[model samples]
Target: MSFEKENIPSGVGGNMADVKKSGYLKKLKTMRKKFFVLRGESSTGPARLEYYDNEKKFRTGSLTKRTIYLRSCFNINRKSDGKNKCALALYTRDDCFAMVADDEETLSEWLQALLEQQQAGLDGAPVPAFGKCLSSQLSTYGKLWWKPKGLGSSKNLSGNYRLCLTSTTINLVKMNCENEDWEFSVSQITSNVGMCCMCNTCI
Candidate 1:
């Protein structure tokens, strides 16, 4: 005996929707961790120091010119235990690249020298030869984050974000759309009532 069965239409659309939702949820979780939670230090460092690169190979001997921005964080006093952070965002045209720093004085000194070199218009001068030194400083509670401004939105969103820098800390604060307000507490750092300074956003 042969039996006939009714055919059911495939629910491919439903399955696709489920997959998309799951992917989105995973992305959201990753963003939350990146922007909110502090997961200690990241192990990645700057890419290999390259002076020049051909289509399929690297030209290590050729003198290459490029413009780069240095974003750094460091401590002010060499003996202090507190976290001090400062950043130098310079539009530099140079032949080398470097990493961030740990202590404030060392970072400041290196930045000062680089700025001087950039002003001198030296040929074949390294962009950031002090990268290792900078990295050492950064490993000691310093964090560096950068984005190509030309590739990012040109919107004037200063009202949506705030940056706080001190002899011991660097804080980036932004409004939370979910709560319709600023974050309750500033991450791992405690907000001092009398020491807090209002920025453009706070006003």
Candidate 2:
């Protein structure tokens, strides 16, 4: 017996939306400029190293201005990081890309172009772009204990602290009349595989 049905539910297929077509749409808007010695860092490979298209068949990735945040390489402290000096950085929340040009002049030109696009996007000018809003989302919270150094083992058993996880940082407060408050970066958290942050003798 053939039980498979071709038709779907009313609410399921009606709400479907079209995917982003920014990729090919952007290429058509910008005109090809005749420039000499235009070099850019490869998206994949060593950090800030000189990149060349060793293979004849190579395609460079393009960025949409609204999705990325741009910063001049000079603004970033790259001394200990081993990043190239003559470079421009473009990043989103999840990914980062650094491009290096031949000279300072070339790098400046690239930076200027990126900034111009960014400003245009901010001004509400139409450009092929994609981005997300993070401000409206709510943060999750959980009960956790914070034990001070030199505190006795008996104090750890009380479980008096409540930790609130925010978008950027962790807000911890002692659940008592004092209402002691503490805030720290989410990156400072260290945890085990099976175990959570709540328990006796938590750091």
Candidate 3:
């Protein structure tokens, strides 16, 4: 329940070779589940909704298109109005959902509670968050980095970088260059300032 590192399925590695070979990648292609955690003022809940893919599940009629839903029922039990403090964390087939937390303790506590509830469930719970995150991250970044012939490739781009702008700056970013080639470079001072916006810590 703690999601030890060793418990993750084998084959995924630092390199992309395993991803192409493993069945996990294929499983993701057909995945239809939407899992998300809702962190609220005084309570938090984790929910999973699975929408049946018409192409994959081909039973006829309106009942065939129905979505299956499952959720763990629990409350965060926070004291005050903590919407500003509340954060949602989840994992999907594409990426790990991590809401920025004030500290590590909050993250660990939520994870522990979630795991305990999962273990107590009648049916086996979903995959561990860490494993799900890793698989999702790899699949996402792999797609971004993969280059197919003919198409201009994103392989040259680094996906980890951040881009942001304030309301006024956003307006400037949206302005037409009018055939002028514009360029901006970050200095050490600008880089430090950029970090605050990138992490959403200042906001």
- Best-fitting candidate, scored by TM-score: 2
Best-matching candidate per lDDT: 2
- Clash pairs, candidate 2, are none
lDDT measured at residue 60 in model 2 versus the true structure, 0 to 100: 30
For residues 71-165, write the lDDT of model 3, one tens digit per residue.
22111122122443434333322222333334456545654544443334314555322222221211211112212221112122222221222
Q: What TM-score, computed on C-alpha atoms, does each candidate reach?
A: 0.20, 0.28, 0.23
Put down candidate 2 lDDT per residue, 67-161, tens digits, no spaces. Answer: 22221111211111144556444422222344555556766665554544344323443221112111113344335554433231423423455
Higher-ranked by TM-score: 1 or 2: 2
User: How accurate locally is residue 4 in candidate 1, as Cα lDDT from 0 to 100?
Assistant: 11
What is the alpha-carbon lDDT of model 3 when measured against the actual structure? 0.25
User: Candidate 1: where is the Cα deviation over 4 Å?
Assistant: 1-66, 69-84, 91-99, 122-203
Alpha carbon RMSD to native, model 2: 17.7
Using TM-score as the measure, what is the rank order of every candidate, best first? 2, 3, 1
